[model samples]
Target: MSIIEARSILILILTMPTLTRQGSFGSILSSWSDSNTRGPTISLHAAAKPLMRFMYHRQVLAFIKKNRDTPLSKPIMEIYSSYLAFKHLSPSTKTTILAELDVRIASRADANAVAESLLDYAANLLDSPDANVRISTWRVLAELAHHRSTATAVLAVQPYRRLVELLNHKNVEVLETAVCALAYLTQWPDGAQAAVSPEILSCLVKLLDSPNSGIRRWTCLILGDAAQHQATEMAVSGHLCIGLISLLSESDSEVVENATYALSWITYSSHGVEATLNADILDVIPALLKSPTPQVRRWTCRIIGHIALHKSRASILRLNPCSMLVSFLSDVNVQLRESAIYALSWLTQWPEGAQAAVTAKVLQYLPALLQYRKPHVTKWLRRMLKHLAQHEAMALAAFRTQLVPLVRLGTLVVSSMQGRYSALTKFLMWQTKARLWIPWRGEMGREVNDVFTGMFGGRKRRENGALIPRTS
Candidate 1:
């Protein structure tokens, strides 16, 4: 036999008495009368222990592949069902045996029959006395939760309360895994409904206050997925809006990123929007825009983008993200620049925002962004600037033809441009080289000041143009 096979055989020979529950000292003394017999037995065990240990992990990996084609074979099933599987086996070994019941069994002839038994076996492990067994059990549930068919079978057992109960566990790893298991379950409709139950959502929201940033991050992610269903959103929005929005300023970039994603979906539905508006979420946006992390900034852009897409300036104007969105038109990150202007695409759709766009100098920077190659950015840039020119006479007059294609002058604004041109045009014509006139290092604050003052009555524009503080 090969070396590994010979060593495994040696281990079985030396260890079977102990494994079979008869290797005690009294038993050994009674069983062996001759010193000659015990000498070789003791020496064989001494040699076998290390070899068996070295092969332990390899055996686990090989067992997975060995059972891959027959995961529910009679002997494999017996190993799981046998009392010795749980009683005598080390927790890690029990974990490996539990892992053997993963999604691979879905295609088996008896998959449906074995699924509940496997799920029941795993569900019981959540209360296992050993922490390692509990952690591995969490992994097994998360794996099962990842597939809808097995997830459906798993959920049918009502594992939500048991899993949610672990949200308060003292172990960081357990709490994080529990959140992930719930997050995976939320991928299905029934799973989401069950997860959003009042007790579970309350525990989830309370976790936002967790001292562990990672736990808070995972909680936010679960809420994000949970927010997709309308019933869940209605149930969660009021309770979760403030907690989630507060995390926007979290010091951890990962926590901030996850919090932003959660807030986006939470504020996505009409009910969510209404609840979010009452929560004063808009008050936090200007501060979040200044967040140093790019991912936080990125998802923050998406949160505002979602609002602007659904709600008009009736509420958005109160937040006045228009000027702030315009400021990033000159940012170093191209995607940030694109998000900046794309955010404006919704804001400029309204007359008030169109006017803000004019003050924010969308006209002056229009030429700078026109140089970009990303088609989407270029499209949003043209569309937003077009919205500005349509509403504000100053914006129309500021347009310099040398900067763009005439085709961008769509019918909405172009129809009015016929037989009527504004001061922006007058100033553009006067400056003729307006494109080459503006400097790149700083902003066009002065150029916009001159344009608006000369035509619109300038009291020197508002410096802190924040939308929320101005709300009555």
Candidate 2:
């Protein structure tokens, strides 16, 4: 349960003989090792019981070290690494050995040493004319980093220069493994930000554009996770947001989520959100809102909120930024409706933003709430009404000269509340302060239910419940 134990397990799982076995071993390792122990030191005794117990792997490692010069040394060394992966060996042991290997590989005198010998074998395996060998070598190299930072650093020397040479290899698995290995290698301390070199970025970008959704998703995820401020800068400066936006329509959920999240994060930086606003990219929101997936809609709403919150000028220039949101107040999906309401309220809290909403005639949509059936729908509507009513002067001004459509809908506002206490509370408050804004007419009845019934028709009794007559 220590960092040493976890890293050891990571190394072991990485060296598993077969991919399927690797998965089984990884699950076991993950479950047995707590996240806090994810670094180095400590060890795992293979839980294989009396026959193949892995607890004392140090003995096996000692045997391999002492006999490393023998004819059986090569296979024994490989078996030892595989066993380490199987036992979930500590990363410290792997890193110590890998560092020694790096020094040996770098020294001509020690070029023929066990460390160098193993790496040379790995290199040869990577270059094998056989596709399986190349794929296997790539996997080993990728996993090597979990145990050895030196091996990780060694891969970045050419930073996939040699791997790139083999990219055109006829085998897709080899190509895929090479890319995966490069990504995995880049996670090492030495390879961290260095992995974002021009060549690697180009390769990843190309893969992102590949016809394969899996490749695109993985590539995007890697780039998003590894390349931080730079990627966002490039995305903004190069107008890549458009292409990134298009990826939202990807068939894969992972691709859509990562792409959407990445774009949103990118737009959060200085002048980033402003850039999108300048381009008038708000039109993208409605499509995303209509997405069949709830998560997509939630993220889209979040992105819109981020833009509105970050850009004051953009908010002012866009008088109707939230004009489209009023319709979503009655969405059948409660979560989307909640998110929409939050965005609208957040925008309205800024005085200039409220002024813009008033100027855009957003109040007109309030009259349509009477047509909705859910109490929850009316609940949020009352909240909005109360908020507007609190700003009595702004409300009256927006109501009279600013919102022609709302006025045209008539003064049935007081009657619309009928028996709804929430609506009634807001109506009373509004009338108390804005009496001059109201036009007394007989058609504008005083009873809450009567006003709404006139506009949307009366509720009818049903065996199950009270159901409103739905005109649309």
| Candidate topping TM-score | 1
In TM-score terms, candidate 2 sits at 0.42
Worst 10 residues of 2 by lDDT: 436-445
Candidate 1 stretches with Cα past 4 Å from truth are 1-92, 98-131, 144-158, 309-320, 330-335, 363-386, 389-472
Q: After superposition, how far is residue 144 of candidate 1 from its true place, in Å?
A: 4.4
Reference-based lDDT, residue 444, model 1: 43
lDDT, candidate 2, 89-171, per-residue tens: 44334434444344333433333333433563455444555454455555656555534534543554343656665444445
Candidate 1 residue 92 C-alpha distance from true site, Å: 4.1
Best by lDDT: 1
lDDT of 1 by residue, 1-472 (tens): 8999999999889876543555545456665464455444457777776666556646666766776776476566654645213544456666666556545544544454456556656556766787777766666667767766677887776778787668778878888888888888887878888998888888887899999887888888888888888767888787888888788777788888888778878877877777777877787777878888765666667677767778645767787776777778788887677777777877877788787877787666765666676767756765665555444354444443322233233221233321112323322322223332331112344544453444334343222321011111
TM-score (C-alpha) between model 1 and the true structure: 0.60
Local lDDT at 296 for model 1: 65
TM-score of each candidate structure, all chains considered together: 0.60, 0.42
